[model samples]
Structures are given as C-alpha cells and as structure tokens.
Target: MQQRKQQLLRRHRQRKRVALLLGLPLLFSSALWFWWLPLPLLLAAWVLHEAYFADHLFYAPGDDYDYRFAGAGVSVSITADGRLGLAQLEGIAEADTLLLEVTIKADWRGCWVDPRVLIDVAQPHDQQTFERGCAGRRVVNLSGLGPALAAGQVRLRGRYCRLAGQATLHVLRNPDYACQRMLILAPHADDAELAAFAQYQRGAEVTIATLTVGELEAEPYQQLGLSAIEAARLKARLRSWDSRHAASWGGVPAERCFQLGYFCMQLPAMRAEPLLGHPSKVAQTGDIRPLRKGNALPLPGDVDGQPSWFNLLGDLRGLIEHYQPQVIVTPHPQLDPHADHQATTAALYEALAVSHHQPQTLLYYANHLHDNDRWPMGEQGEGVALPPALEPLTVAGVWSPSLSGAAQIDKSMALGLMHDLQTPLPGKKKLRRVLQHYLAGRRWPRWGVDEFYRKAIRRHELFFVQPWPIKDQAQRPE
Candidate 1:
C-alpha cells in the first residue's frame, strides 16, 4: 500500500509541473497582444504628429513638368502701372538672338490660367510679331531679322501659364540676373544709427559680413575643391559643430549654415542687424566689402606675428585688435562654401589656441535658403538635414528667442522688399505663408538670462557662461 501511495504522489507532482509550464506561455501571449500591439500603434501616431508639426520639417519635391521654350525674342518691362508687359520679335530674327525668359510661379497647386503679360513700349504701333501657343519658355530665333527689324526694339511679355504658386519667375538673361537682382533688392544700411551704435560705449567691437559659395549645394565637393574624402571629413566636422552646440542652438542652426555654403549670396538686407542692434563697429568682409563704399582693409593673410589659417584671418585678427572687443562674433565653418568660412573658423580657433589676452569668441549661424520648403533637409539630396553630431568649440552660441512673431514678420517683409529684384514670380504667395508659419511656430527653450553663450548641442539650444580666463592660467572650463 505504501509503494502504491508513493507512486501516485510522484505522478501528481509531474502533472502539476506540466500544468505550470503550459500556463506560462498563455499568460505571456495575452500580455503581448494587449500591450505590445497598442504600443506600436501609439508610437506610429506620435511620429506622424511630430513630423507634421516639427518646426524643421521640410516637404518633398513634387512631380516634374516639361518646360518648352517659345522660339521668339521677348522683352519684359515693369510698367509704371505696376503691371508686367511683354513684346515679341519682329526684326530679321536670327537664331540665338537675345531671348528674355521670364518665369512666373504659381502660389499653390492648381490648373493653368492665361494671365496677361502687359508690355509698354514708347510707341504702341510698332510691328510686333506675336508667337501664340509656343512653349512655356521663350526662345528667339533671330536668324531672319531684317536690319530695319533688328534696329527696332520690341517688348515681349507672357505670364506663366501652368506652374505651381510657390514658383517664382527665374529670369535668365544671357548671364544670370538672379544674383544681380538679389543685390539690387537688398536693404540699405542705416548709416546714422550704425554710427551711433558703433560709438556706444562698450567693452567690445562687432563686425558683420556675408559670404557666399556659388552653387555649392547642386555640386558640393567638386565645386568647392574638396575630394569625396575631404567632403566626408568636412561633413563630419560640421556634425561635430552641431553636436557641441546643439544643447543651446538646436540642430537647425548648423544645418542652415551648411546650406548657405552652397547657395549663399550677400543680400543687400541686414535682417540680423536689428536683432543684434548696432555693433560697436560694423566691419564687412568678402564680397560684402565691395558693397560698402568706405576705405576697407584688404583680406587678412596673417594674424599678429603668426601664420594664420586663411587669408581672411590676418584681417580678422587685426580687426579684433583694433576693435579691442571683449567678445567677437563670427559664423561657424558651416556657413561658407569656399574655404573662407572654414578658414575663418580655423583662424579664430588658432588665435584662441595660443593667446590668453583675447576676448570671448561667439559663433552664430544664419540660414542659407530663406524659403521653408528648401530647408537644408531632403530637398536638395539624400543626406540628412541635421548633422550627425556636434563638436566642443572654445565658445558656442545659439539664437535668441527674443524676437516676437510680429517682429519676425516685419523683418521678413523688410527682407523680401529689400530683395525685390529676386522677388518670387506671381503666385508665390505660398512662400510668404510658409515663412509666416515658421515664424509663428518658432520657439527656443529659454535657458534663463544669465548665460551669455548658447550652443545647439542636438535637439536643444543650450546656454553657456563665457567667462574670460585669467592672464596666466588655462581658459576656465565653460
């Protein structure tokens, strides 16, 4: 009887173990179905929300359209009536005659409409040849022009028939007029206020300059004389800059600076100045020097008694000494395409590397392209918009959120007006709307008022105290 009881107990224990093992998976599977399934859905929704509302979000480019040219000589004029006018070729037209191509962009996605291109010639009765239903582009074959017709100046005008609203008329002359128009429409400097600001008692001096690297975005490394390896290195360096400054400046600033390296041209307008107020002195550099009528120093080749990094360094060092500024503000390396910005950054880094008497240096980044859709993201190519990382710099700074929405709007309007020559083609109202939307949503996490230098370390803008070092000791840790 005892043997039989012991055998039964062993069988009961085995049954209990089997039951426990079977229950474990059922419990686990239940938990996963109830919790994990919902988690993924929730995460997806959050990602979508963030993508739509993120301040740095950029839209993808739409489908491409076939643009054909009307084989005709065209002249475009802005009449006193504030209306656009056009005229066609009537002369012994020859091939490759000067064809004025005016592009009018649409404000939004829509069908094509026949908008009149007005033309005002001194005399209205001139024999003007009209080419109807030609391609969207204007082409003049002046091969058959008689001398009499060749001598006669004909005005040509046509509105953009079918294009998106965000499109701007990119008028292409024999030589590109985009840069010239951008300059012509730039803002005028405030001499009196600037002079007064320069005179204001301060411990430091300030200089403002704009640098450009033509068509860097479309052809980055090759155009800029950088090898693929060098370009990769440069990109890594830029990422380091972004990472180091991201805590204070956000990742967008560095990206903006990088974009500027490619498509940058100095605009006549100084939108940043009002925010910065008047510097102790405004020393312009690069192409900016040509715009200023004052006697300007040549680009620097050396600093103090040392060989500088780039030609502009010597001048910057001299300027720093002459100004005796307690703080020096300049663009980060990402801002320029030609080795100019990188050279400047290197020079500043070198200057600070050896000297104990120098003032605190702060780097500020400006946007390269103003339009929202073109934010240094996927618009141009496959590379990521934000840098992969940031570097530890001697001193870093971030943009202040002090400017109000209205103020930003006013500034944008002023800048747009200043760059009237580069004005978007008709129906580009969407660009203005996009800019306004950006301004409205723009905000930087305030890090209190005491921190002087702010760096964008990653996703956030961080502020740092820029204390000067003692004369004999290593610079204090920021």
Candidate 2:
C-alpha cells in the first residue's frame, strides 16, 4: 500500500507540473475575470497528454485490457545528411519483415509541429511517412526494405522531430491475404468493413457473416422524432441493408452477404444461459432468424431460430463447415473490450472445437480496445502501426496489409453508406436534442465526427494472426 501511494503521489506531481507549465501561459494572457481559464485548460491538456504521451498507464488504467508500452529500443544516430542509420540492423538477419518503431518526446515543440518521419527504402524506391503527435509513437513495416536490410543498408529519414530515446525493431511474419477464402464474423454492422475492408476487398474471396443487426441502439434515431421501439426497428432494417450493400460495394455480391438476425448486446447473455432464450433490450422480441442472401446452410433443429447459445453455435458451425474458409476474421477476445465481440469469438472457438475444423489463419482485430478511441494516433490516410499495446503471447504473427490511396477513399465511402455511420441530420429540434444528448452523457456522432472513418482509412490494416486449432492454452478459455 505504501508503494502504491508513492506511485500515485509521483503521478500526481507529474500531472501538476505539466498543468502548471501549460496553464500559466493562459492565465497570464487572460483578463482578471478570465484568469480561471487555466483550470479547464489544464484538464484539456492533461487528457491530451495522457492520450498521446504517457506510457506507464494509458486511458484505461485499471481495466483488464489496458495497454502498456512494450517497445524495446536500440541506439541509433543520424548522419549530417539527416539519414538515420542503425548499425544493429546488420547483425539481425533472422526475419524478412520487421516493424520500425519510433517514439517522439513529449514537449511543447514536439506537440506543435506534429512531426512526420519520412523513411526512404532502397531498391523498391518506396517511401513511408509516419505522423507523430505530442510524444506519440509510430511503427512502419520493413518488408519493402528487405533487400537493403539483408545487406545492412537500412536508413531512415525524419522531418521536424527529434528522437525520444531510441527506436525499436520488431521482427514479424507477414500473412498473405491474396486469393484466400476468407470469412469475416462481425458482431455488428460496419465491423467487417471497419476491421478488414481494405484487406479482403481486392483479391480475396470474402464472405461476411454479421451476427447481429444492432437493434439495441435508440439514440440518434430517437432524435428523428420516433419512439424508442420505432427507432430500434428502423435502425435494424437500415443497418441490415448497410451491411449487405456495403459488402456488395466492395466486390462481394449481395448473394454473398448474410445476416444472422440476432439482437445487439445480447450475445453474452445468450452465452451465459445457453438453454434460455433472451429478448432484445430495445426491440423487445425473442425471434432470431437468418437473413440469407443466397441459400447456404440451414440452422439445425427448429426452422424458426431461438435466441439461445445452442442455435447461435449451431449456425456458426454450419457456416464454417459449408465455407471451409482458409482464413477466419474475428475480434480478439483478450484485446477487444466489447462483450458482443468477445462472445462472438468465444462462440467461434466452441464451434471449431466441436466440428474439428481448423483454418489456415485466424485473424484477430480489436474495434474497442479499452483505450478510449485514442489509438492509431494520427491523421486519416496515414500508415498505422501497431498501437502501443501489451502484446498477446499466443499470436502467431502480425500482419499489416497496405491500402492504396484509392482503396482508402473507397473504404471511407463504404463506411459513409452505413446508416449508423451517417451523422445526425439537422432538424428543427437540433439544439434541444444536442443539449439532451450532452446532458445524458451519450456520444452521438455530429457532423465531421467520423471517428470510425478516421481510424479505419489508414495506409494499412493491422491484425494479430493465429493458426488453428489454437494450441496455445493461454489463448483459449480454461
């Protein structure tokens, strides 16, 4: 307890130091009555500092899936020509691909310019720009620099920034997604697109199986002057349409998209009570059925689906057996904090266990990483490194498939088509609704608040790849 208190005291002191340094300027610049500007300014600066700088504790300090800085650095130096050269690269020839991680020191100057690290890869004539914000870190794949790295000729170029301490190099195996039969298991609409649209859209045989219609949401819809149930029903229908059409837009035909009409936010309850049926929290119904695009596999037992674990698992197993997919994409149960996301993968594990089915690769993604949506920290359209995360021990590999500028725009457009992704339309009661939303402490997407698109339309998509049937006991439930 004493040690804990000491740690807290240290953190508090650090925060106070930062607050005073930032807050004093505003206080000095303001009038007598406005002298209190420092308090709110201090709060805003502190939040941004924690989100972009501090490494010991991220946004979720006490949560199970909170991330920590797990980078290992090697000393490097820049030449007079401003080319960063690391001598250590010559000795490390084990992996063909590596992740170059660079950290920016936190301070006023570093935060102001938002430095961009420009790396020029020889042989391939490739260039990558890593965007940095206030003491933030970024990673870039070294696959394109394979020839130069093997010959100990790796060099990096940075613009308007100084190194924090040292840069890290993480060796990783790249997973091939070309022409593979891929199955995406999405807990809700837009998840498949958010996670892997750029990856599977071009060269892969993609089949999207959405677990729920997301009928539990009634917020922005209720602002449309509909009752709660009416809003829920409308949202379900529109999102179902969005899922199918969005997939279709990505070269996946409408015939390939499927929605297993389960209600949102109910999967965990279904898992806990396998035999019992649970109704939707908003729609207030227990009917669960498959909305098929084309005939595939029938749900076992009753024709009318029951919102039970048995039926959910049966449907999942049936889909797997029919598809025989080489790659299965779902959320990482350990990293993603959403209950539905964790439950979706949990059901997948159980289904694979019973059917004895094994895929070549199980790609895991985290849409909700307990980090308060502040991850992948950069401008839209920039390359995304692995977020500063406590690495999961059982991951077989880490893959980041790059997207062309056109593909990123296409993804942004596809996300725009989703009804839920549509920002709330201006209405007569706009001000009142905005005030109500704020008072209720609910996050409603206003115009230009496209958090999903900002995070999704990156230069590359990241996934933790695992081989199945997973042999790692730590990855599976006891």
Number of the top lDDT candidate: 2
Across 1-478, the per-residue lDDT of candidate 2 in tens digits comes to 1233345457766886886777676677763568677577666665554444432333332122212323444455555443445555554454434676666443343343335555555432333432333345545555435456656565555555655445556655454764788899999989999999876687467888888888876678888899898888888888777777788778887667777778887888898999888878998677765343332445562365678888889888887887788899999866676778888998999988887566888889987664334455445766665554444334466777667779988888788877776665456235433443443222323323556765777777888777777776777632
lDDT, residue 246, model 1: 26
In TM-score terms, candidate 2 sits at 0.74
lDDT (CA) for every model shown?
A: 0.28, 0.66
Specify the poorest-scoring 10-residue window by lDDT in model 1. Answer: 178-187
Instruction: List clashing residue pairs in candidate 2.
Output: none
Error of 2 at 176 (Å): 1.9
Report RMSD (Å) for each prediction in the order shown: 25.9, 7.8
Off by over 4 Å in 2: 1-97, 111-116, 120-138, 142-161, 164-168, 290-296, 390-394, 425-449
Model 1 residue 125 CA deviation (Å) reads 59
